[model samples]
Target: MEATKSADVVVVCAGLVEMAEVEGVDRDTLSLTPGHDELIKRVAAAHKKVAVVLSNGAPVSMPWLADVSAVLEGYLGGQAGAGGLADLLTGKVTPSGKLAETFPLSLEDTSAKPYPGGPLVVEYRESLYVGYRYYDTAKIDVLFPFGYGLSYTKFEYRDLSLKQTGDKVTVSFKVKNSGAVAGKEIAQVYVRDVESTWFRPEKELKGFAKVDLQPGEEKEVSVELGTRAFAYYDTGSKDWVVEAGEFEILVGASSQDIRLKASHKLAGQGIVSAADKAKLASYYNVTPTTEFTLSAFEALLGRPVPANIQPGKGQFTMNTPLSDMTDSFMGRQMNKVMQNEIAKMIKGREDTPTGLTMRTMAKEMPLRSIAMGGGSLNLSKLKAILLMINGHTFQGIKALLGKK
Candidate 1:
């Protein structure tokens, strides 16, 4: 390895400082600096095989992506890294990392609108056209798209299938590692409306699955599309109106690489009537789901109930809160079940009380315990009240919590 400034993941890897210069600048409006071009050339010459790793907080014009033999993103891989990079580089670890942002061929294919902070207060002028949503909607070609990544080993994606089970839609496929080396593969699922009444993206990522495969081994990727996944945030309707229509499902390595695809019409029908859309729009600027925070609580309880459920005609109760039906026996039982599950999660947080005690015994705790005080107390409480029923102040608990 060369003597260079290390970033979170092999930081400042000979060329990062040059790349960082255009961080906040608009890719389309901006041009590459001469110094950056020189730095790129110099870095390419430093290594035996020039593999460009594109990592940034947001998208950048990768006119240079095709120029390099390979590109990997270490997007926001903070602090402790390099070991992972070294492993992937030396073939010790296969590059299983997938992209978190879309890389545009040029900034033009990107969202046409720029951030609103130009000589005025910053505002979101682009509205919904963010990330791949913008590029796909505008039909702009991207350099590299969201969910795009490559591995040393080659994988073949095949056998696309779609089926409707009640309101749920299932898209299943097979991915085989045809290359010599064992590796990991990500199966990407994208959905596009065939007869959308309003303007929509060409395709949107519905789901993704990651799997490990030995050389020549094949694995199945099954993605289920719920009502929510297919629905778009209708600004006018003020709801996620799943308008009745045919939709195309695309499965592939990246957005552009469509290995297999299929189309199906939605079962039953959900019509967002003009009256409903108008009434909803008057109450709020857009549909309720647009501003609602998706809750993990739905997944927390054994049953699926909205943590932060969205408001719509049939999606949820109109006047009654989903969690407020506890007066009824079924509702009370559900509440109890949710409470028990939440308790389990809280208790799980204190799993290593004995380890904290050991650290305290060694008196090696750092001084920033103030930041961690409550956590240590919770652990101690769990060990005493829940684990042993011996509610004594465990030594080193204070130190572990930054109290020392």
Candidate 2:
């Protein structure tokens, strides 16, 4: 706060370093670091010209968004990213990037909650309600919607039309730069089954096109959609089914920001034998099931879901991550040693993003992965550790000797 009070511009670089990031695991939360969030809020409060440049691999929440002047989501920029950011910030080029994933207001607003809950099993009970599919369908307010991006210029959508040639669709629209500067716009195309009274997403992103325009420049953009765009996979029959119905075509800047819409009746031979409407809970409903029930989910899974459980004493395996193994005595000892090792790896720069991530990975990483990731911890040593963790220390010692 003291540093930014006298500064003209405060640029806060924050967000996930590189997602739950690769083979490590899912992130526990969609939040910025406590220190980063505090700095952003305080800095933005002091200086209105706060430009937050987020360099992350996954979507993160921005609670202090309204307090800041500008935000640039620079997700996982590579070697030339610094030069690119300079060009964008210095007005050498116009920003034309769109968010591929929705940024929830908080972790609770997301479809996938209780994330990374257990070591053994995770239930994706939200079914098809994934990403924008869930947010758009549930009408949940988000910090940023999918396919959302802002430019130095404004854009207008006009002459929206859809041409249906048999089962395929070609959606056409005209985009004009309504603002003074030249800019690029992403026109996202979404398809909704207006006649579908089933467990379908309210709308699904089918296709999209990038439109570049000069001031007052207008260009026609078209997106092609095949049968797959209008069909859903039938689990029972193990095939895609496109039932004859009325479909709505939507073109917009994001899933929630629909600019132009048109409806078309798709002519089909009706539902095939593959579509078992009885099991779908669709034949009796007039709208997509918004509130998903456990029974319904279990019915969809074709089996009962096992109760979510956590790893504990006598259950520790080489596959258990250092983080999950805290329930056991030997596991806690192992975690302490690993933390000391990681502390040495980062040394003085323990607070940096790379350092924080390295430390985080060490905790989340499975005991067996040390061998798999080509470290000194081999399979024999891993077996010994597992045996000791499960309360067979003498046996573990014998096993280690046998391996040697």
Candidate 3:
């Protein structure tokens, strides 16, 4: 409050912590550290010239984005990060890097719906439609799209052309540094099947090239697209297929920022074996926005998802999650007793976030994790627990007694 009135510019820093972004654990929200958003809101409210610097590894929801002047995504930039940031902020070096992934408006907007699908099981429901593919196809608004970047200079795109001769394809365009500065611009080329028999992304990145330009300098750039660039794998034929269609070539700075485009009609046909067609037809038509159902996924797996099936006695195996180990009376009792033991271990901190997380993990953990974590489970004890869940309670108790 005291500094805002006197300060010329306010620089607020925000990002995710190690706990929020780790290998095994999944973040509940894309929001930057809980209070960082509010802190930025306050700072932006205090001053009009507010800039934000982000240091997180992944996408973070930024509700206060419009309120701030500038945002620098300084993502986990190693040891010399501070010095490089200084160069960028002071204009000693023009920032020319582009975003590798899309930043969604919220965690819910991401393609991976119901994220952290499981501790023991994970399903790639989105399949091929991930990142920009999902956002562009679904027409969902994003915070920042993939390949998005802003530099010291502005660039213009013109004279885009596309040529296709059977298996060979070429895309050419011109990019000019319209702004009064020298900078490098990355030209991205994406291919779209204007019409297709199977569900596919609106456009796929085929090729890209970086060009250095001076003020008013325009350079022609060409990117070649091979057969693989415009093809999708057909399980029926067990090969890549380029179905007869009109393919659109799009050139842009980012996935959303299309500057130029041209279309070329391709004459190609694919053969689908009847057997594979029967097996794959049901699962092959899932569009970018469509929900990947259990039935569809099962069709792909050629069987029912084991996780979806209710675990019964003789079914609660080592791979089964602890949450599913409650079918029989004996199984329920054993699960209850083990849960009580976990509760006692985390009793004092039960109300805390860490404790809650631990509890959730314990519930989600597979029986194998107990053996690995030394959580009072050895091979013999595990065998006994399996026996208890699998309806041999008397035998399981006998094994427990004889276990060294």
Higher-ranked by TM-score: 1 or 2: 2
Point out the worst 10-residue segment of candidate 3 by lDDT: 279-288
Stretches of candidate 3 above 4 Å error? 78-80, 107-127, 163-166, 214-218, 271-307, 326-353, 374-385, 388-404
Candidate 1 overall lDDT versus native = 0.57
Off by over 4 Å in 2: 1-10, 16-26, 114-116, 269-291, 306-317, 322-340, 343-363, 373-375, 384-399
Give each model's whole-structure lDDT.
Answer: 0.57, 0.80, 0.80
Residue pairs with colliding backbones in model 2 are none
Model 1 clashing residue pairs (backbone): 6-11, 7-11, 105-143, 238-286, 238-287, 239-287, 369-401, 369-402, 370-402
Error of 1 at 110 (Å): 2.7
The most accurate candidate by TM-score is 2
170-263: candidate 1 lDDT, tens digit per residue: 8999999999999998888989888765446678888988889999999888999998767866544466778787999999888777799898
Q: Is candidate 2 or candidate 3 better by TM-score?
A: 2
- Candidate 3 lDDT over 45-70, as tens digits, reads 98999989999999888899899999
TM per candidate = 0.58, 0.82, 0.80
